[model samples]
Target: MTPSNTHTRNTHLSKESEQSQINKAQARYRREASDAAAAFMQFWRKTKEESTVPTKYKELMQLAIVLVQHCRPCINLHTQICVQVGCTRAEILDAANIALAMGGGPVFEYIGYLMQALDEFDPPKEAT
Candidate 1:
């Protein structure tokens, strides 16, 4: 084959190799993220189980932390846990307020997510 043809073939192979490498990196990232999520869940469960604080209180504190961190998923999970553990709406609001105070203006944007979580997990009842 001519040199030009050889160069074209090599360029194609290089591009394919680059794509394969990118795919491998993406797969690795996904695997690591899944593993980290599993580990974190295990640690979270163990801590809640063993803590001297009540589960509801722990969930409340977690809500405050997630609010400050602006983690929507954590807010959803912990808000649901709070409701499951018998936390009142008042208690949830209080935790959110404390987080907002501590987190300042940035926290305001995420508080909407918190409210949406509350609505999703513990919607108000209609009057009889």
Candidate 2:
């Protein structure tokens, strides 16, 4: 084969190898993400089931911690769970206020996001 043809073939092979590596990395990332989600779900269920604390209080505490940590997804999840566990809006708000006091300014900013999640998951009742 001509020298130019050999170089072109080598370049093409290198590109294919790079693409293969990228595909492998993406697959690994997806698998890790799935596994992490599954593990988290298992841990969440076990914690709720085994704890002596009532589920509502646990969810409230989780919401408070997530608010302080500024984890929007956790905030949403725990808020939804809090509602499902029969926690009143007032209770949730009180927990949020405590979080704000503990976390100060950063947690205060996230309160709006928490409210948005609450509205999405457990909107207020309309006036009769």
Candidate 3:
């Protein structure tokens, strides 16, 4: 296993750029399987859009799960979106800790990616 500090995101791309790639891939998939992709995205919206769940908490949960999954594009997209929806640094880190508890050492390395994402996305507002 790599050291805990190792980050696996593509070295040259910004987080937004990573998200762009994911979007492009999604577009391609949608074109390739238009019906299935649309249905899946509809389900995606049903789960991810909104309801009784607050956006901040929902995104925190997503961040934790994605961190454990070690999907760099997901981490990049969700981290920025987490900040945009007003997740505090502490809240984000706490969610990361939950992932760490389940994901162990491999997840620890991925937290390095989360930290950078938080830093980049976290604006200069007051953080909890």
Candidate 4:
């Protein structure tokens, strides 16, 4: 099998490998990519926290979608937090759709990753 196929098949082979991917990503964010991520996040946080945007949560969520579409790592992190804080899934996704609506095909590809992050950070719970 090709390397891509091998990795895809191995992904289901064990939980360790799945976890390793997550760990690797987190480590990269904290190490090699931290400085840039930190600066980006700081600016994002300041904008959302200090600004008087009419609909801050909604606006931020939309911004997150656009940033994720643009592959901005730090914005993705804050976007996840915004979702947890109060932004609805629909609102977040609408933002993503806006990106596709304006940006066309290339921007659409990132929707899955954006949705995946949204799911990971804001998973649905069983109603009890």
Cα RMSD to native, each candidate?
14.9, 15.2, 5.3, 6.7
User: Which model scores highest in lDDT?
Assistant: 3
With a 3 Å backbone cut-off (N, CA, C), the pairs that clash in candidate 4 are none
Q: What is the Cα-based TM-score of model 1?
A: 0.65
Q: Write the per-residue lDDT of candidate 3 for residues 1-128, one digit (tens) a residue.
A: 46443444444355557667778998999999999999988998788777798877899999999999999878877988888888778788889999999999999999988877776777334565
Write one digit per residue (lDDT tens) for candidate 2, span 61-95: 98999999998657867888888878878889999
Question: Global CA lDDT of candidate 4, please?
Answer: 0.62
Candidate 4 per-residue lDDT, tens place, 33-75, comes to 8888788879866665634564546555566556545764434
* Candidate 2 worst ten-residue window by lDDT: 119-128
> How do the candidates rank by lDDT, highest first?
3, 1, 2, 4
Alpha-carbon TM-score of each model against the true structure: 0.65, 0.65, 0.79, 0.52
lDDT of every model, 2 decimals = 0.81, 0.81, 0.82, 0.62
TM-score: model 2 vs. ground truth: 0.65
Cα shift from native, residue 112, model 1 (Å): 0.4
Which of 1 and 4 is ahead in lDDT? Answer: 1
In candidate 1, list every pair of residues with a backbone clash: none
Using TM-score as the measure, what is the rank order of every candidate, best first?
A: 3, 1, 2, 4
Best by TM-score: 3
Which lDDT value does model 4 have at 116?
A: 53
